[model samples]
Target: MKKIFVLDTNVLLHDPQAIFAFDDNEVIIPAVVLEEIDSKKRLADELGRNARSVSRLLDKMRGEGQLHEGIPLPKGGVLKVELNHKSFIRLQEMFGDVTNDNRILAVALNYRLEQEDLAASGTVTAAREVILVSKDVLVRIKADVLGVQAQDYLSDRIIMSSDIYSGYVTLFVHPAVIDEFYTYRYLAVEALQLPVQLNPNEFVILRDEMGSSKSALLRVSMDGGKLEPLYLSNDAVWGITARNAQQRMALELLLNDDIPLVTLNGKAGTGKTLLALAAGLMKVEDEHKYKKLLIARPVVPMGKDIGYLPGEKDEKLRPWMQPIYDNLEFLFDTKKSGDIDKILMGLGSIQVEALTYIRGRSIPGQFIIIDEAQNLTKHEVKTIVSRVGEGSKIVLMGDPEQIDHPYLDSISNGLTHIVERFKGESISGHMTLEKGERSKLAQLAADLL
Candidate 1:
């Protein structure tokens, strides 16, 4: 049976296109929701952008028919602007205030009783299902108390975090194929005899299944034309060698000039930021492929509030960008406490900026590294990528488990979103570093604590 979905304000803010998601179901927007959206429309964040889009969509739709009476939706559903159910009946007594949430609840309750009355009077066959969709957890709980069916708005959410693309696979191929791969230095992708088609640039560990101790680490060619050996080098990248297979895979993409976009995923202490920085320095300073090296990370509020930050841009960013500086110090091998500052001052082409300030600029001829990228939203990531100039490489690295953004999770953050969407593209590559190389204590803390 068709259902009536009462959308909360947050649902529209989370995704402006959410109204069209419910197929063949009537979508009723409470007048309070529009009021809330209107209040948020003047803000500066992504929520404000979504609020504007929602308004534009509604205004465009209003031209078709009267939204209050109900309008035809594309997928055999009705979109209605519910204006009359503003005051609460018993909900006002229970909640003590007719707040926006309670007012929305009143609308749903009013619909339920009206539909039930019509069904009881034989005006309709049966009462239609009424569901309140919201992204707020507390609202859903309150809805349950008020005897309303509520669910999370999850059309944009990725289902499983554990099932995210790891960008590599292990295969136990026949011993002869391994030997041929070694001799020829490349093998046909068709000879993998795999269950499914491998993504371009995906790494594979081919172990000899004949009970022999022989193996080779190969990567799927960019065109899926062949399986080729990795550019595994014993040479250290700014004093850090590839400690494991995943790191080597990460470096292969990092150092490769062909792949312009790369994403690295791992837990803390896995060297995601360090490795990307090392490669960025190599390409920009050593190889001279890019004119400058630009590093930026989202300024997440953790130790103190951003408003409480006291200083000019550089001084204020000292705390958040310290982690990046620490990695740089490690790469530059700065022994003294203030030596990193000297090194940074000497590099005329290096830029350490915040993601907030990096927007609206055409960044080209630079190697850009975005650290802690999991804290970003999809629209934020899209904006960042669009700012990349004609000849630059962008690396997005983060630990999915350590996300600080409240609305994001392991699978829904911008880092994982880019990994999933860019896997098949030739210019993109990904690596998930499992091992923590920071220290034994840090690894233990990450695992157990």
Candidate 2:
């Protein structure tokens, strides 16, 4: 049975096309949602882009039919704008104030109550059910309190967002088994009984019984204890090399097209963003696998303020994107920082974008790198990913352990959530780089602090 999905304004901002994501289901856009979208349309960021997109989409649908009644969607669904004033009355009475969020919730509550009344009267309505879908946690909780069937938008369900795998696991194998793999080069599971927590392409260093001089690099295989070559490839772009085994695994995952979604976690100076940018440049500049190299990172600060940088838009962005520029300079072997700017200017194919402006744009055949993904909420990440057109690969890299957002942490951060949710899927892979290749001092500091 087709259900009535009442969309909240936050859901549309999280994904402008979310109205069409539900197959054949009737989508109801509350009248208050339009007011919310109109208010956000003036902002010059991702939110503004989404608000504009929703406005344009509604306009286009109006050409076909009236939105107040219902319009036929191209994807075989009914879309309607709910203008029920009864909901506004109910909302004003319940909440005592006409806040934007409360108004949206009121629309949902009215629809649910009407449905329940119809059901109680023994009338078999075609509307399967009324579900209030939102990206805001607070909104969903509010809906539940009002006795409505509220749910979070599943398009952003990357899972617990907490409890994401850190990609490093220490397995205590038998001393004799570690000895045999060193000499034989491959250890069969029959020979050594290890646990089942291992994954393919995962690296393990076999330690001796005494925990000294027994460290040997080994790759886990699908067929139980079968060990293979370390398989670190040297075909990396931008002259960047993996500083550690976990980095090697991360590089492999980033370069592999089969893995569309990759999540890299590490502390500062671990080179997660640098390696991803290098790989993207190589694929776009040399391999011609992609048409463009597009880099975007959240505008969150890391330990300092970016107060009042002088210049134009690009100059203002430069301060925020300096780390990316530094990596590009290192990759292009440019002697001076300005030389990297010249190279980027000369090659118009590469673009360094701010995550705030990625909404409502369809990026195709491009290698897109999203840095500092840990600062993004799950809703923000969904908004970015949904804009990916055909033949595009997006790599989300961040240090989950170093989130700066007050509302987000390791588990709730977008990067960690994507990694944990997409793990073991054929189209996605992840790696956590443990070894710090920045410097001896950096490594010691990371370990000690």
Candidate 3:
């Protein structure tokens, strides 16, 4: 049956192309949603950009037919800008104020009654299902209270968090396979006789199936043809060494020049930012592989502009970029105040940037790190990653479980989305660090609190 979907303002803000997502279904945009989108179209953030995009899309569709009556969507759905259902009589007693959310609810509730009335009168065969689509949890709950079927706009959401790829897997093999891996220092992928296919640059732990302790740690070749030994040296990066197996895997991906894109997922205190910075510094300063080290993070929840802060651009970015400064100071072993800043000024090879300015710029031959990446949306991440030019490496690291974006969750955030989407590509690699090496107290707090 063809269902009628009433879209909330947030759904359009979260994704401008959400109108075409419901296949062959009648999608109704509440007039209040348009008002909200119009209100946001003047800002200079991701929300404002999305609001403008939605306005353009709606205007283009208006040329085909009057939006109030209805129009055929290119992707097999009918879209209509609902204007007659603004009456708040159905919700006046339950929700006194004629707020925007209440007005949206009234539109959906009126649609439901109209559908039922037509069905009861035999004007139509049966009532079409009316579903309210929104990204807000409280809005969905309130929709349920008003007896409207509601669901999240999930077109951009990736898989569940539990099934997300962890970059490494353990394979139980015969004792001979482990011995061969050790003797040759590399093994053919066919020798494993695996049941499932491994992704490019995926780490593997070969354990003896004969109940022996013999094992070998290796990684799949970028072409997935061979299991090669890790090329990592015993030397520490920026005075930091991997304390756990997953951290070691993260370094392997981080240090490899062939893999231009790396993603790290971990809980707080798992050393995600530290490892990324160490590898970036080693590549930019020591190896001279990249021209500079550029770091960025979202001044999150959109519209929290660094422009509102005092001083120059660098001074404005200091607060949001303090975590990066701490990591850099530790790497440089700075004991005096303002020493790291002087070192950065003297080095002239490192740049700390805001995520706001990263858009619409081509970044090439730089070791780029995006901290707190989980706070970004998929579109924002796409814009950032697509800006990478020739001879550059971009590392996106963050704690997916600790996202603060109002419209994004663990699976839907830009960090996790890119991790899953790029896991199969040869140019990209991912690692999920499980152990926290910051300190005993910090680890305990992360687990307990």
Candidate 4:
């Protein structure tokens, strides 16, 4: 049976290429959905970008064929811009008002009735399955009340929440493997009994099979041919040490100039941002491996209109970037409160800016840290990644369970998507920090409160 998939405006705004996702099926775009997209095409956010893309795609399709009748999609599906189904008399009698959502529901209801009529008259050869695709929860709920099939648009998701990659695995090995790993610092990949293929730079904890509580933190070689011991640092960064095993793994990836991309995820006080900043400072300031250290995060919980602040652009960003500044101050170990500002000015190798200015520039020989990256969409993350120039490293760190985006969640956010998509590659590494090392109170709050 051939199914008709109706796309909601939110689905198009979530992903502009959603029209062609259906395989060999009929795609329907309600006329009112276009109106909604038109109203949102002028904004300056990701939504605006997607809306314009959808508009351009529709206009290009019009040149190929008449959309009112039906146009052939490149993926063997038919795309139709539904007009003249705006009559909401049937819906108003049941669901009350005819808002944009209700109007879309009315179009879907009309499609169901038309299909049923064709089936009854033998005009249709088989049963037709009509489904409404939307990203809005309320729209899906309303669709269910009206006896319509609806589902969320998940074209960008690479994994389920429970199946998300954790970048590390535990193996029960012989006690002498730990002894050999400590003596020679490298173990052959085939020496251990494994269940799956290991990615480059993936961390592993080898425990004793005799249950003697013996373990070692080791990393898979970039060639996936051997397991190498972690380069445990004796000196701490600004009096901060890697308190847990995951933090040690994150530091290993961050400090390696060969790895161009790294991702870290953890809840509050897991030392993700703090550790990344520390490693970035070590690379840019001490070793001189990079020209500068640039840090940027999206301005969430408050939209990007900076007019209400009292001072200039930097001053406007002061409040939003204070958490970053606090970490820098802690790393620099300032005696007085105002001395950290002088240190930052003296170094001249650090830049703390907003994510808005990162779109159109080529950044080479720099270490870029994007904090709170889970709030970003997959497309936004792509834009940020494509701007990386030669000899540069980008670390994306965020807590997916703490996302603030209205349309994103733990499984669909860019942070999780990148972790899943870049797992087996040589240029990327990931770690999920489980412990909170800020303070006893903070750790207790993370666990109990």
Show pairs that collide, candidate 4. Answer: none
| Model 2 regions more than 4 Å off | 23-25, 38-44, 59-64, 72-77, 124-129, 158-177, 186-201, 205-216, 220-226, 229-263, 266-297, 300-370, 375-396, 400-429, 433-449
lDDT of 3: 0.90
Residue 270 miss distance in model 1 (angstroms): 1.1
Rank all candidate structures by their lDDT, best first, as comma-separated numbers: 3, 4, 1, 2
- What is the TM-score (0 to 1) of candidate 3? 0.95
State the lDDT of candidate 2 residue by residue for 1-449, as single tens digits.
77888998888876788888888888999888998999989876556777899999888879998899999876788999998757767666767876878877877878877877877787865435789998677888888878778887776445555556765456666677777776777876445656656555455666775666656666666443566545456555578877666777777777777556677788877888888987887788888999998998877732223347787668778877888988888778888648988898899989998776676799989999998898887667878888888999998888877877754556666777677766655566577776778788998988888
Candidate 1 lDDT, 128-244, residue by residue in tens = 988999877788898888888999887887647667989899888789988998899999887666876789999989888887989999999899878998875757887889898
Per-residue CA lDDT of model 4 for 1-449, tens digit only, reads 77999999999988899998898999999999999999989988888888999999999999998998999988789999898564478678887876999888878877887888898999978659889998889989988888889999887678878888888998888899899998998999986758777899999999999999899989998888899988767458656788888888889999988899999999899999899999999899889999999999988732356568798999888888888999988888877877877888898999998888788799999999999999988888888998999999999999999888888889998889899999999899999999999988988998886
Q: How far is candidate 4 from the true structure (C-alpha RMSD, Å)?
A: 2.3
Stretches > 4 Å off in candidate 1:
84-89, 92-97, 301-308
- In model 1, state the lDDT of residue 151: 92
Better TM-score candidate (2, 3): 3
What's the TM-score of each model vs. the native? 0.93, 0.59, 0.95, 0.93
Clash pairs (backbone) in predicted model 2: 161-411, 162-411
User: Scored by Cα lDDT, where does model 2 land?
Assistant: 0.76
lDDT of 3 by residue, 146-238 (tens): 889999988877697688889999989999988887888899888668977899999998888898898888999999889999999656998
- Clash pairs detected, candidate 3: none
The RMSD of every model to the true structure, in order and in angstroms, is: 2.5, 7.9, 1.7, 2.3
Better of 3 and 4 by TM-score: 3
Per-residue error at 408 for model 4, in Å? Answer: 2.0
